[model samples]
Target: MSPPAYSRVLLKLSGEALMGDQGYGVDPAVVTRIADEVAEIRDIGVQVAIVIGGGNIFRGMAGSARGMDRATADYMGMLATVMNGLALQDGLEHHGVPTRVLTAIEMRSVAEPFIRRRAIRHLEKGRVVVFAAGTGNPYFTTDTAAALRAMEVKADVILKATKVDGIYTADPKQDPSATRYDRITYLQVLEQGLKVMDATAISLCMDNKMPIVVLDLNERGNMRRAIMGEHVGSLVTV
Candidate 1:
């Protein structure tokens, strides 16, 4: 087979993706499926690093909306992310793929602290690095964390795995008239308020001239196809 299109990629997986068909928390079957997909990409010689969100366990914004302190809620959300990181690590390792769980909150007992150089080194050595805890700060989403980590690691692109196959003009599930965009501009996404990613994350990628590919994680082999540059989803570019 031909070499992969991208040597390195940062995969942004939302916590809800881990829930699968369940209402909340993780589904072991979903984790295993994701692990298998990740392993396939790694076996193809593509360096993979991931930043997982904690929406499945806890959402800081949701808490804040319920009158809780925003910062405190965000911290709790960060901890939830760590829990997800561990789960993903377990799944990946079970498939014989070496993985590391690094947290921004400095949990020395369970995971290593987030170190940029060390993370890159881990990827270089063929170990997938899972960045958890959402930048170790409040008021930032995991989307922003993904962008920041991708830039730090100099990843070629960010693969944002979502439930939908690609970004649509409207919510596809609710609006049958919605259409998917094969390619879109950062300015357009911002102006239209498309939910491809958060504004902060989009701005970060735009400023750095980094590209993002939004694809459906539930689709079998979609992640591999995206990594291979097969036009699997919508591409957001400058």
Candidate 2:
């Protein structure tokens, strides 16, 4: 196999991506499949870091909308992400891939606290570092955390794993005519109010010039193809 186009990459996975055909919570088979892909890229010399969301378990925004305290709901959401991190870690280790779960909220008994240097070190040492807890802040989404962590680690690109193959002009499921974008600019995403990432995340990437490759998570080999610089999904950049 050819060397990976990117030396280091930050993979952003939504909690829904882990749910498979189920309505809620993670599906073990899905997690194992993702682990296999991560191991494949690691074996080929790609340093991987992951920032996972918690919508499969809990979504703070949804909780808040249901008359719950925003901050408290968000904290619970963070804990959900930690659960996902541990699950992914278990899967990766099962595949014989060295892995670490670093949480922004500082659960030392379960996992290491988020330290910038420590995360980079873990990646350098050939360990997949899974960043959990979504920036340890209530207002911020995991999307922002992914962008922040990617820039902090100086990653070559952010591989955004979503259900759809790429960003569309509209909701593809709702609108059959919704078209896919092969490549798009950050400003275009914001101006059009596209659902790629939240505005904050998109703006952060735009300011820092961090590229984001949006690809389908359920499709086998899609992640590796994106990392190898193939035209497998939509490329989002300045």
Candidate 3:
């Protein structure tokens, strides 16, 4: 087999993606399918680290909109991510993939605290590290955490797995004339107010000269193709 294009990659998955066709919560079959794909990439020699969102179980912003304290709601969302991380870890382990869950917040009983060196070590040993807790701070999105972790671990790229195939001129679901962008710049994303990721996350990647590939995770094999450096999604750069 050919060597993988990237030695290390950070995959950003939203919690909603784990819901499959369900309205809420994780769908076991969907988690297992994603785990299998991760295992496949690992077998091909790609060091994988993941940062997952908690919108499926709890969205902090939504809670705040409904009159909840912003910080409290955000903390609740962080805990929800821990739950998703554990579920993902279990799925990966079931496929015989070594995995670890590291959290920004101290959750000694459930997972290890986030230690940059420890996370890098885990990757070096071929253990998939799942990062949970949105930087242990309120108001920060998981997208920012993914970018930070990717830089700390020196990941070659970030694969943002979402429902859409790529970044578009407009929301394809809502706009019939929306067009996908094969490549785009971080500045262009921000100037246009495109929701490829939050401004903070995009800025971080831009300053660090890191590339992000946005692709549809619901499509089987798309993740693998992304890791293999195929043109399967929109490439975002400085």
lDDT for each candidate structure:
0.96, 0.95, 0.95
Residue-pair clashes per candidate: 0, 0, 0
lDDT of 3 at 209: 97
TM-score (all chains, Cα) for each model: 0.99, 0.98, 0.98
- Candidate 3 segments exceeding 4 Å error: none
**Per-residue CA lDDT of candidate 2, range 137-182, in tens?**
9989999999999999999999999989999999999999999999
Q: Model 2's lDDT to the true fold?
A: 0.95
Worst 10 residues of 1 by lDDT: 224-233
* TM-score: model 2 vs. ground truth: 0.98
Give the C-alpha miss distance for residue 144 in model 2, angstroms: 0.6
State the lDDT of candidate 1 residue by residue for 35-75, as single tens digits. Answer: 99999999999999999999999999999999999999999
Clash pairs detected, candidate 1: none
The true-versus-predicted C-alpha distance at residue 75 of model 2, in Å, is: 0.8
The lDDT of model 1 is 0.96
